[model samples]
Target: MGNEQSKEKEKHVFSTHELVFNQLNEAPVYCFDQNVSSEGLAFSHSNLKVRFPSRQDQFQVAYLNAYLQLGHVDQTLSVRARLEDSVGSIAVIGFGESNTRSHSDLYLFDVTQRKVYLCGDEVPNVRLPVCGDGDIIQFQVDIGRGRLSYQIINSASSKQESATAGDRSLVTFKFDSADLPHSVRPLFGMRSTSVTEPSFHVLEVSRELSLTDKALFDKESIYGPVTLSNDCLNISRQDIKSNCCALIDKVLREGTHRWKIRILKDVGASTCLGIAKHPFYVPNMYGMSSQHMYLHSQLMVWRSYGGSLYSSGSKLSHELRPLDYDDKPVTVEFLLDLTAGTLEIIREGVSLGIAFKGIKPPVQPVVVFYAGCEKEVQLVSFHSNAPSGNNDDPILLKQSGSKRSSDRVTKKHKKRISYAFDRSMTYGSLLISPDGMTVERRQSHIGNAYCLINQTCSTGVYNWSFKINEDQGASICLGITTEPVEVTNDAIYESKSMYLYRSYMGKLYYNGRELRKEFEEFWMPGTIVELILDLVNGVLQILVNGINQGVCFGNLEAKAYRPIVCFYAAMPKSITLLKFEHFPSEPKAMFVPNNLNQGMPFQSNGLSEDIEKGIQRTDRCMVCSAIDGNVVILPCKHAVYCAAHAVVGEYCIVCERRIESIVNVF
Candidate 1:
């Protein structure tokens, strides 16, 4: 039985070796190595293994039955080795079957780095009482993606008191094939004191590395060419031309370029001049400057130097003066070269003078008339120079002359505007005339006293109603009526006062108390009361039946408020307010305390002499009045017109031709 058992163990060990070798062959070339030996058996390119001591006393072994060594035939890479097993197997190995042994662990090795990653030296041995089986164990290793992994697992429970004995069922390990040495070997196996053998199956699979795939991928490999179409090119051209001039100016001002200028043409002429300047320094000389000027025509060149003083001013100060000289219009050309610090200007096939020496190369050349005295000017033509290499091809101006007709301009300024206040007209109706004058000649009306009652009640409950006049005054009449007494009561109450109150801007106004209260339900028969509200100038003027009562002055600050006049009626009859009037006072000038004539117009000494002589003979002339030599004028335009004979349209006042519009000048 012993010999039979030994033969069976040998067969199991040989099968394990075959399984490992076959597994290695099936996997990628970097899976295992064939140059590691243990005891009498050599573990070359193989899977992981675990072993135990044999019970046979005669056979004292130096190595265990289960062991493994792996290598990569195709690459020099590091491989991790480990063990794995089922959960039941782990429980059996962790806790002994009868609490005889402790737990089990795993061992790891990196063949490429040639170092032991983890040394699972001590493992517990255990046995399962129910199954009556000892712990089972195995190992695994994987190599891929420049990394390695390894693990170990015990499948059974074995109650073994030995320190290095446990039921380890399974193990796993992995590594990167790229980390392995191309012709290297792996060393891994078990050690024991007796001849014992364990069994294991090998696994091998190919793993594609994400890193390698990423390194080899290319986006352009899938898509083709990227080029703009003709339409796109045209669009780009339009955009460039529209913004290019301004962009060029900005670049020349802020960029390394030293100077820039815009030359506009004089009216009705085609010739233009553009000048630019650049500054440089010489080692031995003072700083020097260069000016590049463009003359759109030979006529312009002649006119510029001809000493004709058509316009006075230096080129820097004068604006673009019109050139009325007879000459063919010429387009301008521009050229700039930073390397040589030179700008070439050509117009109508003519080259302007090269300005190589100047005080500060004209950043912007002072424009001068083409044929007039060389005075500074501002306007220059856009066609002063065409872009280089493009001949005569007029760079169409992006912004043409205004399209609005001259007639329209004249018509817009000639119309008369008006404002109407009729209800048929829309609210806020303001019509502008072509002449730009505003005419507001219409008036809004406030009807009967009953209307006043409605207006007042609505104002108290809702919003107040008032007529706003353009002359800076408003009429507010409250809608309220008074009740009248009978004939018998009228005798005893000769006068009965009924008060009508209205509020404006935090203040209240009592228009008047009327004696007649006859028209309480309809239009009140009492006198109509109205107030001229001048909130702007802060004054309230009261009026009873269109008669001015008095004016009150105070601070009346409200967003929307007007002076309101109320009336009370003692008889039942319609009290009609003929018209709502708002007469705002005009501003007057006062003397400057010490000087009476400070704001008055000056008069000649001759006039003063004549006036003095005339004043002596005019005590009855009725056309002169002088107090402290300051004269007063009447409506007849008569200066110092006496009170008695200040006749209208009969005398001259300050040389006034018969008074058409009587204007009082103070």
Candidate 2:
């Protein structure tokens, strides 16, 4: 138990302090300084003022020093000090350039012995232009290996230059007096030929390393093996000084274990690589090259849920046996090429899946490598095929089901009728009974000879109204009639009765007055006359009673057209039949008759009496002027009729016929 506890404790490891530096001071410490003139340059030592005195005085001047690892410093480097006067005078004292005549000479001194080594050295110098009254000069020193160089710049010109020794080597500088001018101040700077050491620390307790930190460190440095051990773990450094050979033997014997490895690189520094361990079911037996190596084990695996294996690949040619034929272990080998965006599966030296031509492979392979019941497995090796140059394509995974359906229906509706006439008629009377039945009438003759009520009339009636004789030119009377009228000429002419005669020779008359003279045939056979009964902006136009004759133009009066209910006819020489046809009913297109004078007059079948009751029931009696009293019912209950009314059954809305019966209602 104690050993186990110790082992657990040993899981953490610490590193030695490879290098150390003094706090130096929150305020910057004077490192080095130099003075320069046109004749030569000189180096000087710094005097550090201490806040608290030790054994001597509160102020002390010590040689500034730094400790570095072995081989850290090389030739061409040395340590030195520099000083500048208030008037822009400058000097340098150090381990190099101490000749008074040489422009590269420096003041030399030995601080431990308190002896002056070299003084008033003149080296190649650069003088800066003077500045304001109290302008201070600036100086800097470069140290490395066993050599040093010093320089200074004035406030005015602010230019700088370096000096060298006669032997082209380093020299030490010292001063006999320790006193400095009241107006002169020492300024220092340092430069080295050695590479700069990183200021980062590995063992900062405040900053604990996480998995991501470990991964990033492993990705950056090549000297350290990010380690986990019973005794010590160092992120960037490992020391095996005590048991180096023993540790090496142990590592060699145990080899590497197969585990997931995550390597993170600085986004601006390097590329990243990730590798995961294979399970026991998938065998990982692929060989490795120098650039690429297996992660750990020699086999990969994918465990099966029901001991059933499904094969997947770009194209499957044959079934592959498990790596462990006895089902003891199941695994498969797959190759991933980041640059080409491809993944290939190899089984038994045969290529089973090559999914590289397109995008990246899915998160996991379509087929599991080792699939039986194993919980853990191993991977032998892994390496990059290339630098992942630019695999622009993304991985695609297959789905299992179909997509959803849209919502709108897409069909059409059927049509009903065909060609239809769209025009208007003139001088024609349209009759609409109370029950929605409609009829049209036109007068074809004078003296009530021919009345085309609904497409039916006698020939003599049509002739007396429409045809006039050339010789003697019989006079004609015109009267408009919507109902069938009895034709009688020169026989039993009663008062207020319509008649046509030739008494005026060439004039037609209705009541002994000439209706039309020299008769241009106002009512001629096949003549179509249209009367504008009413017009309202040409929209609500009534050609006769219930007929809407659409829009019209031209003068109706000049055309011998009048709104009065009248007809046209000539004296008897020949009579032509006038026919009238009613427009079709509801949902049917309206028809405008062409020749009003040629329409046949309407005739009742003498069954008007029987149908009258049915017409009255439908309430389509139009001849009577009764507002509402005892109403007569039709057989169809659609029309009504009364006595003393000319019951035109053909024009009756009820029963869709003319009202022909006189029925008394209780």
Candidate 3:
């Protein structure tokens, strides 16, 4: 029984004749050292061992480079492998025009300076600590266009502790196999001073990778071609002009079917790769938001620069910014599921977690490449994993943690926020536009309120700005506070208030005392007033027309705070609230105050700004007390708005006291 098992370990003969492994023994599956014998190479402990390690220069006795017998075609391939805990380098042992190892190509943990090389370039020295603990190394190869691309990843980190597709790995990145053969062989080599022969080594070869497209591009074509071939549909880099780069016809079924488009390229440079339900056409990443999905009457999800995924224009996963991708071979995949109304992203076989959910149905892959870009984005393949459009049918999906778009966005600003208006928190006479980008005070009364969906995380600058569209003096107090505000009340800066405010005079008032002053006079209309909470300096800086006003108020602690805007304007005018912005752009938009001061001012501004009986309230609505209170806001608890004026801007008209965060709520 032991002898027969040893024979089985000697080799694995497959029916497809595409792969052949020598199991854990000696000899090469494809190539063997001229001086090495079958008995010279042995598997001891859990590592490969040569008969003699001191004889490093003596042929087969000291070194052995064994190649797998399995042969792969010049297309896309996925070969899953597991590496035992060893500091010594083991080359997958194949190179263009040669199959050998050099000291420079030793895969290192600290990525090398010459990390990325094209065809005829040296092998990459990769070092991944994740692989130090016997992790799954998803070794993938793509052989096409007379070149080979290699990719490796740690299934552990990528899966987020989820059962890996197989095991674990150390490093991950995709690159072309330059100067390699069209029909290539696999290799497993062992070389190192710390190599141990303990445990066991295993290779789990899954299904072979094949192109789903009917045809591939003709490499011999000298001129650019866009026409289809008899067995293969053809589209070249030249055919991609403007944003109309590539479009596959595999549309998915609504509520059931999900579709994915795979492109072997980098995802950045203003290009957008996504799935749309209709015949979509967009100019750029920004245009993709309003352009295609509207015409198709469905949802759209795409991947942009540095691996930043997006649904429409809003970002999905900012965690993997501009993915740690170089100009190597990458399988940029965009997955859209109608069953869950979600979209996911996968790069080089590494799962990037679920991107977006609540995406409406009917989707197809739409790739747009801008002209004059050097990035080669080829629509190499596509497929659908969904069943027919069955609302009752359930599909088995294993996805990483992703955010839900359908969840009440009031709690989350990064997903979607400025939808016509702050569904809640606007008071009487407040008119927000249809897109909620503009807010207007229709009534001359003194009780308009506005607040933004500011999810405070901490650190960095928290800011938002608005252009004085109409006139000034809604009292227009811009401040940061912890207490929830009401539009019926005045600009409360003191008396039990742990917040600060600044009127047109640019004076930071905390508890009725001027804590910090920026300007001596009131600000002019049409000037952009940027309210900035500099958490690092522990102060709030107000900027007018890009001019920094030093520090407004300091002593903000590390806690949740809101950006508030209250106004009982002197005139019935308007102000356009722009998207929430911050200095030194960061993907993480939370503002967690860390400098809580025990002596932070809490005194109120004393006198309230509410309308008295003597001040004649005119032009305001009778129900909500607004001149043109339009659109009923949905989210805030103290919601009060009429069904007439346009709902626009970020600040809540009623619950509008403090700046919640400095993220792009609009």
Give Cα-based local distance difference scores for all models.
0.24, 0.23, 0.40
TM-score of each: 0.16, 0.15, 0.26
- The digit string of per-residue lDDT tens for model 1 on 1-666 reads 999966764442322223322222112222222212223432333323433233322211112222221221112122222222211221111100111122122233321122234223322232211211232222233333233332232223342223242222222333333333222223333332234342222322222211110011011110001111211110011100000000111112121122222222232222233332211000000010111112111101112222111111123322222334334333344444333544455544455533232222213222222221112122122222323432111111111121112112223222211211122221121221111111122233222121122111111111112222232122122322233311122211122222233321212222233211111111222233444344333323333322222232222232343222232232211122223222222211110011111123424233433232322111112121222222333333233333443445543322333433222222
* Per-residue lDDT over 521-636 for candidate 3, one digit per residue giving the tens place of the 0 to 100 score: 32455556656666654556554543334334544566666665555544565666654643333222232112222222222223123311112111222222313222223332
Q: Pick the candidate with the highest TM-score.
A: 3
Off by over 4 Å in 1: 1-39, 42-149, 157-186, 195-666
Candidate 1's TM-score reads: 0.16
Candidate 2: where are CA atoms >4 Å away?
1-150, 155-337, 342-666
- Tens digits of per-residue lDDT, candidate 2, 1-666, equal 999966774443222231111221111122322111111212221212111111221112222222111111111222222121212111122332211333223333322122232224332332222222112222222222222222222122232112222321223322322121111122121211223211111111110011111111111111101222221111111221100000100000111111121111111111111222111111111111111111113112221221112222111233333233332333345565534644455543566555233332222211111111112222323223222322111111011111111000100111111111111212322221111111222233233322222222211111011211121232223332222233344321121233232223323333333332232233333221222221111110111111112212211111111111222233332322111111122111111111111112222334344443323231222322122223343333332333444343533322233344434543
Reference-based TM-score, model 2: 0.15
For model 1, state the Cα shift of residue 621 in Å.
99
Superposed Cα deviation of residue 382, candidate 1 (Å): 52
lDDT ranking, best first? 3, 1, 2
